[model samples]
Each structure stands twice: as C-alpha cells, then as structure tokens.
Target: MDKETAKNIRESLKADCSNCFGLCCTALNIVASSDFAINKNAGTPCPNLNDEFRCKIHQNLREKGFKGCTVFDCLGAGQKVSQNIFNGQNWRENPEIAEKMFSVFPVMEQLYEMIAFISEALTYEVSFSLHDNLNQQLEKLQNLTDMDADSLLSIDLVMCRFPIKELLLETSQYIRSELSSKVFAIKKGKECSGADWIGKNFSGKDLRTTDLRGAYLIATDLRNTDLRGVDFIGADLRDANLSGANLSTSLFLTQMQINSAKGNEKTILPSHLQRPYHWI
Candidate 1:
C-alpha cells in the first residue's frame, strides 16, 4: 500500500465513539480498583451507560472514579462490530445475540489493534524492504475484519499476533539502526526490553533508540526525556511522567499509552497523536 492509503487506513483505525454502540462499556469485565469505582461483569452494561449507548459520566469520568473508561481505546472496532458485523443491532434490543455479540467484540478489538500496528509500520521508510510482507499482512487482517461475527469469534488471536510481532520487531530494529553507533555506545548496558523499571526516575535522560518494549514503566519518571526512536510497544506507562518528553519519532506508540500517562502542552508527540485532554 502507498503512504497515502496507509495514512487513510490509520486514520480510520481511530476510535469513533459516536458511531459505536458502547461495546466497551458493556462487553468487557471491570474490577474495582484505582481505575474503576465498582466491579462489573462481562456482557453487563455499565450502570453509567445510558439508553443512547453513551457514557452518562463521560464529562467527568475521572472525577466519577471511572479512570479506566477514560483510558480505553477500541481503535474503531466498536463501530465496525456495531455497524458492519451485526448491522447496527445493539445487544439490548436483540437479547438473543447479546452473548455472541459480546464475545465477538473483543475478538474484533484484537484484530483492529493489529491492523493499527501494521498500518503504522507501513508508513516507515526504514521498513521499505518489509513493505511487501507488511502490506500482505495488512490486507489479510482487513479481510478478516470483514468476515461475519462467527468467523471473527473463531479467529486465533495469539497465532495471528505472532508473525505481526516479529514484523514489528524487525521494523523497530530498522528504524533504530539508523542512529549512530556512538549513540548506542553512550547508553550501553541500558537495554531495557521487558525490564522492570516501575517508579524509577529517568528524568531529563537521553533515551534515544531505547528498547522499552513490554517494559514495566508504571509510575516511572521521564520528564524532559529525549525518547525519539524509542520502541514503546506494550510498555506500561500508567502515571509515568512525560511533562516535557519528546516522543515525536517514537516507534509503535499508541493513543492508549499516551492517555494512560501524564503529560503537558510541552510534551512533543507525533503528528498523528492527539494531546490528552487531562494533560496540563
């Protein structure tokens, strides 16, 4: 796929709550914690979800103790499942299909997430050699999304994600390799792939091209950090300080990760991402 096409696809992958049926509010289970005020079972509508399929406390979700809701991003799967898969039929009106719809919702979520990653990977000039492979995978995943609800439920998400993960890793390496060897030498022995750095202070550090994939960065401090070309896929950034961090060229950073973290107007983000409303 060309860059323009890929950009359009990436734009479509963003969440459009107005076109959705509040699947995230009803289909997913929620536990009472700092992120949530009450326990909620899977397939049960959140008490705050009203008849119009909108959150009643959307304007004040954080204050109302629904922080989790504020961080959740369905990547446009909700509308796809609501409008395309089930033809706009909501679970409440169609009780017979409720269970199946709920089951299919999460499956679609995983698919959309993969699609989002692949679409972003396609736009990288460093990954040109892998573009053919990436485009093929993107097409295959897009086709899967167009499948019926039963086919979506039958998908083996783990198997589907394995190859995509490998591709993303390869793409990440390509992007990071463009940096000078001296830069890597400066941060030698600081390889943090999947490392536990929870609550660690990394304020004002030069972290260019760092491998933070799957890293535990919960509540870690990263204020004013130079994070360009850093691989942040699957990194837990909850409450991590990003007050003045520059992530303009970071690899595989998503909106959900940005939303879960704290930042300010001074934080430099990629062009495709929006600054969180909660950010100061």
Candidate 2:
C-alpha cells in the first residue's frame, strides 16, 4: 500500500466514540476499586452509559472514580462489533447475542490494536526493509477481522500476537540503531528496567534509545527530556511529569501510559495518539 493509504488505515483504526455504541461500557465488567466507582457484570450496561450510547460522566470520569474509563481505548472495535458483526444490532434489542458479542469484542479489539501499531510501523522509514512482509501480514490480519463472529471467537490471540510482536521489536531496534548515530554527551546508555525511580528528578536528561522496559517511573520528573526511541512499553508512569518531553517518536508508548503520566501543552506526543483530558 502507498504511504497515504497506510496512514488512512492507521487513522481509521483509532477510537471514534461517535461511531461506537458504548460497547466498552457494557461488554466489559469493572470492579469497585481504584480504577472504577462500582462493581458491574460483564453483560450489564454501566449506569453512566446514557440511552444515546454516550457516557454521561465522560467529561468528569476522573472526578467520579472512573479514571479507567478515560484511559480506555477500544481501537475502533466497538463500532466494528456493533455495526459489522451484528449489523448495527445492540444488546438491548437482542439480548440473546449479548454474551457472544462481549466475547467477540475483546478479540476484535486485540486485532485492531495490532492493526493500528503495525500500520504505524509501516509509516516509519526504518521499517522499509520489512515493508513487504509487514504489508502481507497486515492484509492477512485485516481479512481475519472480516470473518464471522464464530470464526473470530475461535482465534487464539496468543499465537497471533507472537510473530507480530517480533516484527514490532525488530522495527524498534532498527530505528534505535539509526538514532544511535547522533552524538550527544547525555545519559544515553542505561538499563533502568524494573528499577525504582519514583519521585526522582530526570529533567533535561537525554534518554534517547534507552531500554526502559518494565521500569518503575511513578511520580518521576522527566520534563524537557529527549525521549525519542525510548522503550516505555511496561514503564510505570503514574503521576510522572513529562512536560516538554519529546515523546512524539517514542517507541512502544501507548495511550494508557500517556493517561497515567502528567504533561502540559508543551509535551509532544505521537501522531496517532490524543492528548489526555487531565493534561494541562
């Protein structure tokens, strides 16, 4: 596919609540804990879900103990199941299919997540060497998404995600290698994975192309840092300050990570991600 076509596919895979039927609010259950306000069953619709399929407390989710809702992104699976799988039928109209719909929703979401990330990888110039292979896999996964609900439910996500994860890791390594050419007297060589750095100051540090996987960075300061190519897949960023940080090209950074961290208008983000509502 051309660059523009790939870009469009990436954009299309994003969460568009206007086109969705609040599937996440109904299909998934939540416990009364730090993440949510109350306990809810899998098939039961959330009380905050309005009749119009909109979240009543969407704007005030953080204040209402539903911070989890603000961080969640279905990656376009909600509308896919609501429209494509069931022909725009909802659980309220057909309660019989609710259980099956809920089951299929997660599977489809996983597929779309892969679609989104793989498509994004294709946009990077470093991924050109794997373009043919990536395109072939992307097309195969897209075709799988079009299968019937029964077929979708039978798919083993573990087996499917294995090879895709390898591709992404390879892509990240390639980009990191390219970035290593730029010289800078910065703290660029460090293995801080699984290390406790909570409430520590790292402002103006050069962490480019660093391996920070599975690191504990909760409530840490990272303001105005050069974070390009940093591996933040499993980093704990809760309450971490990222103001003016250059994460626009960061590796493996997700919406969940961004939501957990604190940033101002100056903090740069990836092209496909939206700024968190709580961010100043």
Candidate 3:
C-alpha cells in the first residue's frame, strides 16, 4: 500500500531486455541530438553502431553531441524482440516481410511497456495480492510473444490494450494509496543510520530488511556497502553511482534490474553484471 513495497515489485516486471533484439534502434526513426549529426530511422543503423552491434562512438556520444541517445531505453526490446525473435531479419531488404515485422514490432514494444508498468505496480504492497494475478498475465504475455511469427501477427492488438490499461489502473490505485508516504533519498554524503550500504558510503548501514521502494537514486555515488537483502523496486537508477556495492544476495534485482543501475570503473558490482560499454 505504501511507496516502499510498491517500489520492489515494479523493478522485477521491467522487461529483461538483455534477452531482446536491438529493434528500436534498427527499426525506428531517431534524430541525432546536439551530440551528433544526421537523423536515422527505426530500421536504419546509427553510424555509431559497430560490427559488434555496439555504439562505436558511445564514449563520445555526448561530447560529440548525441545527448539524447544516452537517455534512450528500448525497454530491452532492441535485443529481445528484434534480433532474437526476428533473427536479424531487417525489413529494409525484404519489403514483403516489412509489414508484418513492423506491425509485430510495435506490439512487442507495447507489451514491454505494459510489463514495465505492471512491474512498477507489483512494487506496491497493495498490489502484492495482485502479483499472482499479474504474474499469470505476464506469463500469458510471454507465451504470446513466443508464438511463431504467423501466430504473433494474428494476435489482437485490442487484447494488449485492455491488459495494459488494467495493469496501469491497478498500479495507479496502489500509488494513490501511498500518497501520504515520505520517500527516502539515498545521497552521496554522510550515511543514514539503519540504512543498508554495501560497499557504498553506508557500507556498514544495517539495511538488511530496509524497504527501498521507488527511490530515485539517479547517478548517486555508491560504493562498498552491504546489500544483503535490499529491495530496489521502481528505483530510477539510471546512471546512478554504484562503485563498490556488494549485491550478492540483493532482492528483486534481475538482469534488467542491474542494467538499469549505474556502474563504472570504480564500481564494485556482482560478477554477472556487465558494465554498459557507455560507462567504461
């Protein structure tokens, strides 16, 4: 019902985008920001992309004037649905396949977005009971996504609209229920007592059972702190500072979870978490 609990659930439901294809980058139209020149389309590869499927100019994207690119998140659809599902099939070459693939593209994208909303909704304790129900829905959605191309294309778009709308309504209800709650602001300065900080400033803070739901830790400095059982629901951790946080047994942190958090050279993270090339 409160903010803390709602935060954790949302973190999990955010799409596991690493298992996705780079669809949005290759399929949609994106104009260069102040950091770079030249506009591109969804199916067109950005000049920065290399043979490795990574941005060649990632490091200089900002300095080179492509600041907008840095903030873009495809919700993991780039790899999941694009490369994985389509198997590197680009609509540009085969105009015949373009229509179906393009149609399916937005469906999966919408599904991914809905999953994110539901993930955020799950963070609210009020939605705890709804977890099973939502989980079932998620499973159903995943199954739908896994269907063959023919079946996927045949799916009713309206079906997704209802499910997504319903999940949003429930999440909104949960958030509204906690309107009177106070949010915790994890900072870079002195440590807050009873707070968990694994390998971070609060490295010794006893945040073992702390509720860190929906906390906006955007680019905050974190290193060498205890994260035994911390909940990281709905935390907009984009570009946050995680230098030495020990997240061995962290709660609710999935592949997508780690990807969303900020990490850098000095960041001591779990072995499995690959630091985004942009960070290095």
Candidate 4:
C-alpha cells in the first residue's frame, strides 16, 4: 500500500474531539474510582465539560483522578455521529434526543473499531493476501457509518463483529507465520491464554508468536523484549514495563492496553497507537 493511503487510514481512525459534541463525557457513565475522579450516570453531562464542548481539565485529567479520559478514544465515531447522523444537533440544544444519541454512539464506536483493525491489517505486508477482503469490509463499514441514527441503532453488532474478528485472527496468524526464525520462540504446549502471570518478570524475553490472550500480565517486566506477533487481546498490562520493546508488529494491541501500561521513549509502538502521557 502507498504511504498516503496508510496515512489517511490512520488519520480517519484517530479521535478528533473538536468536531465532536463531547459524547464520551456525556453519553457514557463514569464511576468514582481509580479511573475517574467522580461518579456520573449515563446521559448526564460531565461537570468538567465547558460551554465550548471541551474538557475543562483536559491538561490535568490524570492528576485530577480522571485518568480514564486520557486513555479513551472514540476512534472518530463522535464527529461522524454529530455531523453525519444528527447534522450538528446536540443533546443540549434538544434534550429529547439524548437517549437515542447515546445508544447510537456505542454502536458506532464498535463499528469504527472494526474499521481500525481492518485498516491496520491492510497496512501489514504479510497480510497482503487479505487486502481485498479487508478493503471490502472497510467500504461496507464506511457506508454504514454514514447511515442515520435509526439505521445505526438497528445494526446487528454480534453478526457484524463475528466475521471481522475471524478475519483479524487469520490475518494475525499470517503475519506471525512469516516472522524470522532467529526471533525468540514461544513456549510450546504452554497455556497461552487465560494464564495468571501478574507481576512476573519477562524482561528482555523473545516473545514472538506467543498466544497471550486473556493473560494477566499486570506489572510484568517486558523491557526490551521482541514482542512481534504476540496476541494481546484481553491481556491485562497495567503497570507493565514495555521500555525498548518492539510492539510495532504486535497483534490486537488496543489503545486501552497501551494506556494502562507503562512505557518509555525507547518503546516502539504501532503507527495507529500513541504512547501514554503518564509514561516518563
């Protein structure tokens, strides 16, 4: 794929809150805990949101106990809902549509996430064989994104997610299969998924092609490791050290995972994901 297409794909998925109506802060609920500073129920506007549809504490969110906001990304779904679905109409101006708007937001969020995954798969050279399939799915979802609020709410998310997930898994395997043999080999016959590995030290390990799905890796030391093609879906990486690690090729690594983890300047990340601000 050309560099420009790849750049456009990434830009389309990145969150653009300025064009949004602060849907995340209003449509979703937040609890008073480590993640959020205060409690808020669904459909209620966050007190921190200002008249300009901007977070008042945007700069000091983590410091103010609203760390959840820093890691959350709607993947550009907010603007699509605000501009395309409702034509710039917000709940504040017309409170009657608040519930419908909130319901449609989550559906669009999941749809956009699938788009992000498929878009990422298209960028991989090893996944070239699946480019046609990914492109078809991308176009379909892009069309769905342009639909009105009623149509978006009617989508069968279960049916839509299953096929996309299968495609993603297959694409991940294709990429992992092509990795060089010189890389560290994952342990054979070891329980790859749902393993409790919290606080374990895996520093500088060769973890290529590892099936680490649903694994509890909280506070694990993964510094400078070769993590190419490792399936990180459902892995808990809270407080994990990923300094100097090569994660550009990791599979299913989401922004939530990166946001919850610890990383340094030496950590190599995928093009679509950004480093967490809390990391020094």
Best by lDDT: 1
Candidate 4 residue lDDT tens string, 1-280: 5535854785568778988899999989899988898999988899999988899999999999998888788888998888879888988887888899988998999998888777777766644558777777888888999888899999999999888878877776666665534344433222377878888888998877777878999889999988877888778988789989999778778888899888999999977788887888
lDDT of 2 at 79: 89
Give the clash total for candidate 4. Answer: 0
Where does candidate 2 stray beyond 4 Å?
Answer: 127-129, 182-196
lDDT of each: 0.89, 0.83, 0.54, 0.82
- Give the Cα error of residue 229 in candidate 1, in Å: 0.2
Per-residue alpha-carbon lDDT of model 3 for 1-280, expressed as tens digits? 3445445534433334344434444556776645347788666667676555466776777677775565555455555555666777655555576656655777676666556555545544554657776666766766776776678778787876686666654544444334324232332222222343332344334444244556556555555555543555445565555556666534344444565565557654433344556665
Ranking by TM-score: 1, 2, 4, 3
Q: How many clashing pairs per prediction, in order?
A: 0, 0, 55, 0
Ranking by lDDT: 1, 2, 4, 3
lDDT of 1 by residue, 44-96 (tens): 99999999999999999999999989898998899999999999888888999
TM-score of each: 0.95, 0.90, 0.52, 0.89
Model 2 pairs whose backbones collide: none
Instruction: Using lDDT as the measure, name the better of candidate 2 and candidate 3.
Output: 2
Clashing pairs in 4: none
Candidate 3: Cα lDDT at 83? 65
